[model samples]
Target chain A: MSVTSTTSQPNYHILSVLVQNRSGVLARVAGLFARRGYNIFSLAVAPTEDDALSRITIVVDVESTPLEQIVKQLFKLIEVVKISELDPRRSVERELLLATVRATCDDRGQVVELANIFEGKILAVGADAITVSLDGHPDKLDDFEELLRGYGIVELQRTGRVALPKLDREARLRAVKGKVV
Target chain B: MKMTGAQALIKALEMEGTEVMFGLPGGCILPAYDPLLDSSIRHILVRHEQGAGHMAEGYAHVTGRPGVAMVTSGPAATNMVTPLCDAYMDSIPMVCITGQVPTSAIGTDAFQECDTVGITRSVTKHNELVMSAQDLPLAIRQAFHIATTGRPGPTLIDIPKDVLQNSMEWHWPTDAEVIDSLPGYRPTMKGHPRMIKEAARLILESERPILYVGGGVLKARAAEALLELAELTNIHVVTTLMARGAFPDSHPLCLGMPGMHGTASAITAMQQSDLLVALGARFDDRITGKVSSFAQQAKIIHVDIDPAEQGKVRRPDVPIVGDCRLVIEEIVKAIRELLATGSTQADTSVWKSRISGWREQFPLSYEPSEPGEALKPQFCLEALRDSAPPDTILVSGVGQHQMWSSQYWRFDKPYTWVNSGGLGTMGFSVPAAIGAKVGRPEATVWAIDGDGCFQMTAQELVTASTERIPVKVAILNNSYLGMVRQWQEMFYEERYSEVYLSPDTPDFVKWAEAMGCVGIRVDSPEEVQPAIDRANSIDDRPVVVDFRVAASEKVFPMVPAGFGNDDLLLPPSQMARKEFLR
Candidate 1:
């Protein structure tokens, strides 16, 4: 059943979840979103500095579910240690995209030139194709993928966005001013 | 000290103060069962894993603690899915431990192996598969903590056999060890002072106010505070089916149950009210038929512990997320302060009289059977209520008999009425009653079941009889799934397809006797009270009284599934009257 709203415009929500680094924890977290019918637009997971803990960043559309409901549901999982909603405006968001396009001998140099224009690196060179990698904000990566699609892209993959909250500038300035000699 | 994982699990459960468990043993769980024999905790072997799960739920329902259930891998875990879902739906605190194949054999299609964690994850509040024996203690501790705290629900810990057999250094962890590990599970207990004050103001300003109580009040042990608020404000209270015993049925302001089979007065009062003080109650579709029209005129002040439940079904004007007991206490205090400051006085006498008029005009009534006729289920329930002790805990299986019992029995105290409210599991009564009896040995417990429901889990009676729990089981033997039959009769052109059960197959009394329970069958109206009395008098063993109630009896004052609350259908006698529709 659709909970909360039906007519409201969907807003993007980025939730950073800290969980125990154990087998099946990721599956349990993903299963919660799937079972609740909440669409996960993007997700990234990596072990935290502490080996015992793992951090997962998820981007979801909050049209059918309220943010409070999603957070509460996430908290219900015992393996989930902590969850914080990252404000998109105050967080650094990045995505990595890798694509392989069919590059004939004549167009291989052209492909390299185009990759340079987009700040992309050539990861691998095949007989008829070159794999290019790009890392930037999701929008930039989207732009890069759109430009490459014209080259008859043979393969494409994108890592969902991962984000970190930026330190508050005002608070950091005040802390710096209040620093002890 | 070093101990095997299974031994450490037993020790952990003991530290958690788990006195009893319900389970059945299997190959994967054999090692755990071996340790159980030496542990102080008593294990009641169940015929089915589902029975074990429900028994734990029943135990938890009464004790306000997490009930523990254990079963092996594969089919055993699959059998437990229903009870887990049932407990999850009702938000009952339960811990289910399932044995798994050895760690190396997890994905090899080993004997009696299944993905216990994967299967139970959606049904449980949380679940885990122990990768190491060292994690067992913390996992069990976390299971108990998660199960009991923050909107209680079932949690599972799947243990592979090798892990249970492996040795680990064991020590009982301090409170800090357990609490420090769980960083994200803090539940807000105190309602915001500003919201409490606003709720009080709304209640004071309401001309026709009703307090809508749900199962959360009982779960939070806030019934006394709820009663205090109702009596102090003179506001009428309508307890939903799950909240049957939350308010005294005999109270002047109590409007009985308000839902599908709710009393006419209760349904009408809710429909006509200007304001609703909803305490720990979610506006479930069962309680609020046709959500758009339910309490349309009422400005709701919804108080519950779970924030997700705030606007899940019905958005409240004022939503307070906190523990029910603490929130209700705050509301009572705020109301008292308001009265002292001359801000408001209880001036709902006019609205109160209108409710009283409704109560008198459309009381819950059933036709009394003629002499030597088949007994009415309502009559049997009333007789059972009269004969059973006042403090007796009434457990019910689902269907028409459940509604009839909820409608007819007058519950005066909280925790005395236990039934499957959200899931409405059919075979919940017998095992749950046994669990209730085990939890509260001093109190009398009765499993008021139906013929169809009794057949589903009647074998649990053998466990009760063998354990000497002495719970009473009253079968309202109507020879049909009466609720379905009633719906068919009313809405399906009387096409009773598969609703009817043959009377000759496995008579309930004979089945009860076979299980070593004191079996008594009553066919006539006069035999109803006598049978109940006989059942009540038996203390050494469990008693089963089969009252052959009217097969065609129907539950009245139904809102008819998807219909609006205002479209309540009264009893057949009043069905033709158009005036009562309003």
Candidate 2:
């Protein structure tokens, strides 16, 4: 995959690293980022279908050093098997965000209507607060969170971004058009 | 069949072809020591854990094998931090096995227990704590594999006490099994043909090109291939400090070393070159001086095994990631094709004359000693070079002595010059010299050390004397931390802060004698050659010769810290102009 041309302003980039599912591998990867003074905007890690391997998705804001250097350093980790830089433009990105917001009698209806508009579900409703969950693109989740803050968010949690490359044009057209053969 | 974890560890080391290890035993490592009694591998008991680590580094530097060191938990493991960092900086292949407390007692702060893996994680290429007896073999195997492959560095395996004592069923696995298991470690051995061709094109088209070789050339055993390319292209070559022996110094096109204290000719040539063909050499701060200005005119073609090092410092116009030997071979082949088709002809007569002019104008020289005056350190080094065998391996500690030795000694072959280049580690010479001697038993080994650095690890001579390693140490006893003193003289307005190593403080001759070594002291200029000859003749035990050289002498053609190579200062006699700037 190609790294996009560097712009004057710093931009966030996502790196998906596949590594051995063993103790201290995550720490080693994180330690490398910390030692190199690279800022990690968000980090998500979990095991893959193969029990022996794990996938770590890290979003870093590039400031000084090139993304090529960061990827090379990640490859230096003995546990890291493969690293793929997911271009935001070419990949489908999603994040799961959960928020507990104050929803008293007056604001309950407004909050519910906003949640419904964002395709969010109410997980639990309490006397003072209601817990709402939404799964969508990172920017969509950010927009939903901004609306929820109007009702006074008591707590907020976000499962960083996970990405998968978009299908080829033929497959996308077939899937979108709902055509067999 | 069943075997104890310690026995399995020993068996695994044997399977990896480990013939020797340097270590010091303590309470936690005692279990591993017991199994060593029946093992075939020779263990050299070092005075300190640090000594053990450096000795292993020395051995690894000479032979392209991963040197092994074993130390106990806590303080013993802590002592290995210096050498671990040293090995990491230089990318030396080494495996350090540290003993740990029982697995159950790992977090409880048991006696002589510490976070071995945590402590070494940043410094080592990789580290593992073996929590189970069954995992010991695989961990040991993985450690060796990781330590020796791709840009090689030190790896540590911490075996808990109980893990070593516990017994388990064991079977020796074939090489294929080990190979299949390590999926994450695949080192690219072949260069991309396109990149190789592009590099060759750059080399052929450039008017002023220089082959900037580094330690990776020696690591990849690509010296012959590199020399062939240099000769074919009719280009001058500069070997970095870590790459002293990578190219023969006697070659007509060879520009000795280029960097902080590099030869003026080499530095100037690099600064003036239009293209820099950097093979396996990182543009280290010491070599580059000021990053932005270093080789500003040169278009770089960097070929290294580690992709991380490609753009880590200076960006290369053509970056090829592969083994040095393979890449050089491909480049040579591509050049041959180009020559066959008459695509390009490398005619660098103008560049050659400019470099030769610099070589003649600023030759490496020292001030002659006045009648009956104290001997100069450079004179002692020159004498040693003349007296010693052609194959003698010269290892040195960091300081003025290291720079002087690198400047004066004419290394004819690869693997003959060993020193701590990246880390600038003091006290590295004595133990490293012993290790080099151990690795190359037929070749005479000498540790040319400074007085201040010699004092730091002089006790390792006991191990050398007792073990009959027969490595000679020549101490340039200038009564000061000479390199620092020189810097202080030049930059710090001659404020010599704590740099003076007093003459009467634990006399080196008496100390060497106490350590059961042949101690010889040379005071005058006349005694330098005789002392080196006498020391060279002794083969039964290690020798320490204290040469009281002139303290005021300084290494010249120095690019002060943060200065460009073009701004090098020549010696007073060689300086026609005060400040020589490009």
Candidate 3:
């Protein structure tokens, strides 16, 4: 709901930008970042509950750009409806990871147990490799991928990160949208 | 009625009340030009696409409407990029229609094809590539709506050739439908009342305050409100180059331009002020020489239509996002309400005294040329200013002449001063002047260009001549790229690298004659006034006056490249004193 500053600096800040669901909206959004020279770490886009609108979850590194400016420029984009920062403390973020791990039949049980412990699923079973898919918080996904790496992973893919503000009303509410820093 | 997309496009332009447009015919745009033959709209065929674009800008500047410029795909569209970017930077309301390649040929490198929508996405406020004949009218409508609205800017509609060739039933949407179509695009008309009250309170509390005006005031047509605020608050106004005539220059509270090449008085006043009510002026780098060192003592009340511009450079204490005129009007009302509650206007007598003293200390000046020496460019401009009517629209190309035009002219009216400000585009004057002339046919338009700028786009004079626009051109032909030469002399140790543009090679007077314009040459002090007078007398054709000026002159009171405004460098003779350094 708000961008509350933390003592520790974050390498990347996530922004959930609600935009009009129009053709070429993605290119327009991505083009804005490129035009302004804003470093975009990763982006995930999908239609929201309303079919007319889409939320583009952007992970942007604000080392050079002031976060306020990035948000302000986004507001200028014609299709951008609303921009809200997903503060690390007050937002839930998740990423989907699909990996093909190198494992022998003897090590298959260990890999499957690791996947189960991380809430992952075995999609395919090969002679020496097992394909696993995991959906969880990006950090948990990272840990799961690391465990699979020891089993000699052949391929890996992460679906960037998608986020939503934590719906706890009693807690602190600091709205920074359209606010000048 | 069923009509081709090309017919619909022309009909849409007519519906938008387009009186004139400047453009050229080419492969893709040829179809639209065909329907144009039946429309009542006047189309001025320009020599180059850049000229067409700039001409539209000039027209918009005078008319306060979105100017239209059309060009074919690829190279022609690319040529319009400068003017589109120029209009975008200055926030001129313009709709540039580019004839794109056929929808099927797009992204496949068809002959005369281009990714115009992709290329201009950043430079334009909004751009759409019309894919279907049915979408043409709505797209054109959207283009104008987006272009002329909030924080007005250049918008483009790229129509594929096939879309134009295809036919569909004409459907002109109502104004409400146009508004409903772009739900994400609504401009804030009024400032938040609380912020308005806070801004008014600041004006009441602050002793040393100044209204820092920019082009936004002009864009909003809020000069009267700005004038009211300044008078009511008794604050001196520093109009940036872009906002030259937004506040009358002859007003007692007016302090000419501020920033690099700005008046020393304006620069010092800004640095010394306690509160700066910045209306529509983004704190550009040229204005804020060193961002960290700029206006350290001032509290900012920044009002702009674009919320992004509020704190883009300096964090404002009170940031109001709304139309400039509307916010200023609200502030005026708030000030009156507060004053009724026993609050008094802040006294600014002592500040006025200091402003007057500074103005006297370093008035804009130039060394006079004797009978034998070439006329001073500043002197020539002064003559033109005196010889021309007070209402004459003055346009200038970028460089020394632009700075001088801003400095020398006494503009008392809004929309009288037009130039390429944000983009600093050279060769903007000729075509822009033509456009301005076309927009306001009764008023005389003079394009004050430098030798360097004139050579770049003087061919537009042929358009003016054939079209009988009767716009006058005064080229300060100093035989060199004067501004560059001045910088080289001052900064690069006088090693004038490629700056020496031979004075006599193309003979501007003869060149003007060749273009069917009345060409006059003047090199003496006495001849300057006569030349301008003669040019003013000619109404049948465009006039080109080549005033050979002294090449050594430099625009002064300059804030050097890296230094802060506090460290202003006056003329070379006064550099040692540093008396202006506050």
Candidate 4:
């Protein structure tokens, strides 16, 4: 809910929304934001563990619309069950980057080595191009993509950011130590 | 019992105690109309789909029940969009059942097909497309529940033709089951204890507190509780236009409607107050013209069932999301408990006197009747207001007549005065008056409409006559669209534009006679009362009284949209619009 916590361009909110799995629900949710003139930076919808529900991860720019207005408007949708904002400081966010980069037999090692450094997988290689898929934090992917630009970027795709709250310190410590409650 | 979806729809309506519904039949909805033949519920066939929707709204307003309307897809459903928006804006609980194209034919762009649910999504609180016959009962149950609960508004259920024709085993869902299915929808019905105490404390301690009541109070049926709370604090009450009759106008503490066209006293009282206890009212732009400067001295305590409305406009110092009646009842109890412990009430006597002084100095008045001049619209309204029974229900369409009706009428009861406040829907009165009369049969209902507004839905009088609903209509005829003319004269430098509607084009008298009702035309001030009395005396059919009034008179004291309430242009001063607009 607090977009001011993290200093970034175009103050944003990553809302993790749980919605009733019903026909046209996505349209309803998306239509509301469009109708209200709120900009949706990126949206990713997938079925949740519950077959009757779906989780929609929406990265929305809070530039013109108030964060509460977004939350309240979304809640007005009957299909929407809950909305919780994922704080950048307390959550983990990552995107998948699939790119086809220009690489010849002469400089294929440097391309492979750079991919190796980012723990990216080499999907396919041709006479003049190498395909790679990298999954990491959006910032990390940004840095990796910047380096790949030198190899002459051909085609690229980034799955919009998906996030979940990171386990608290106590829970993490307890899990590492295997402590009983 | 195995029954067709159409039969189940009827059975569900009966289960919800819907005695009557307004509708217009069409191809897709034909199957449902057949079931109505065997059902106990009476269907009032309307001339237009919009009339049916407004009738349902009017019915809901007086009866505290979800008014039901049925219509078919495509044009018929499209025709209902206005009423849906109107009901949505006013928070009227209504259920509109639309017959959609069959599920198999839905995406094919079949004949007479439109996405009813999709088109009406924003206007309705909730809407559903019943794809299966089995979901009909539950869809209806949920529709009523959603429409009547929380901050009530219109809800819709679009049933496909095939679905209605399909058969399913009937099973009525209990309230718990309905609640269980909708996991996300839970309205806060009561205020938190701590918040209630704090609100009571503020009410008791503030020296200049005013109760800014709104339509939500009437929606909640919280008028009694509101009256109790207001009396307990001895606070002055200013009902918003949406809340005209929510507080008794006869009460000494009541300051008429507050906002753009509100009374000078109400406007000033709100402007100067230290504490504003806004109950069931959003700080709508109309009420808060130039909102930043509106009631700058007041710390607002807002109570509403809708959370989104809490800080939508003016941020409340104490925001309590709950039913107005429950919240106000609790606040009253909390205040009493505090008072029992030796807490004293704030001294609002000086504030009260100042308000009284303003009320006296700038009382709602108009140009007096000249010997031969056209009858004043305000004079006609006062005649109707004064002659009507104390409990008679008054309805008005939006325009100069509507503003005059609000300004002049002495409404001392809740639900007795109904209008399209939020939507400002012209032509609402003609059909809404019919619905209100139907809902409250014994009470005399009147539609105070403008010449422009009356022309829009006057055809509904044929439906009223056929149904034998005796509602009276008063057309404050001013040749021109009076409100539009006034605005043009004041703001647009008197360029008359396309506002003038030739008065004699379709004679309202002949129009009423053709519709099988009594029509009376009054052109002078003296004829106002006699015409109203004559109209009231007739109980056989609807009565339309057209009072030709002067178009030059405009509503005042005017805040002139986008200006602060503090800058009211009380007439004679209205001629000095340049000074205020500057």
Query: For each of the candidates, what fraction of the native contacts does it recover?
Result: 0.62, 0.76, 0.62, 0.59
lDDT of model 3, residue B86: 97
* lDDT of each residue in B358-403, candidate 1, tens digit only: 8877888888888777888888888888887869999999999899
Segments in model 3 whose C-alpha atoms lie over 4 Å from true places: A1-11, A169-181, B573-577
Question: Stretches of candidate 1 above 4 Å error?
Answer: A1-10, A166-168, A171-181, B371-373, B576-582
**Residue A181, candidate 1: how far off, in angstroms?**
19
For candidate 1, give the lDDT of residue B47: 86
Write model 4 residue lDDT over B181-290, tens digit each, in one string. Answer: 99889888988888889999999999999999999999889999999998888899999988988999999989999899898888888988999999999999889899
Question: Where does candidate 4 chain A have its weakest 10-residue lDDT segment?
Answer: A1-10
Q: Could you give the interface RMSD of candidate 4 in angstroms? A: 0.9
Q: Rank the candidates by DockQ, best first.
A: 2, 4, 3, 1
lDDT of each: 0.88, 0.89, 0.90, 0.90
Question: Model 2: which docking level applies?
Answer: medium
Worst 10 residues of 3 chain B by lDDT: B573-582
DockQ of each: 0.54, 0.71, 0.58, 0.68
DockQ (0 to 1) for model 3: 0.58
lDDT of 2 by residue, B97-164 (tens): 99999888889989998998988999999899988878888888888988998889999999999999
TM-score of each: 0.95, 0.95, 0.95, 0.96
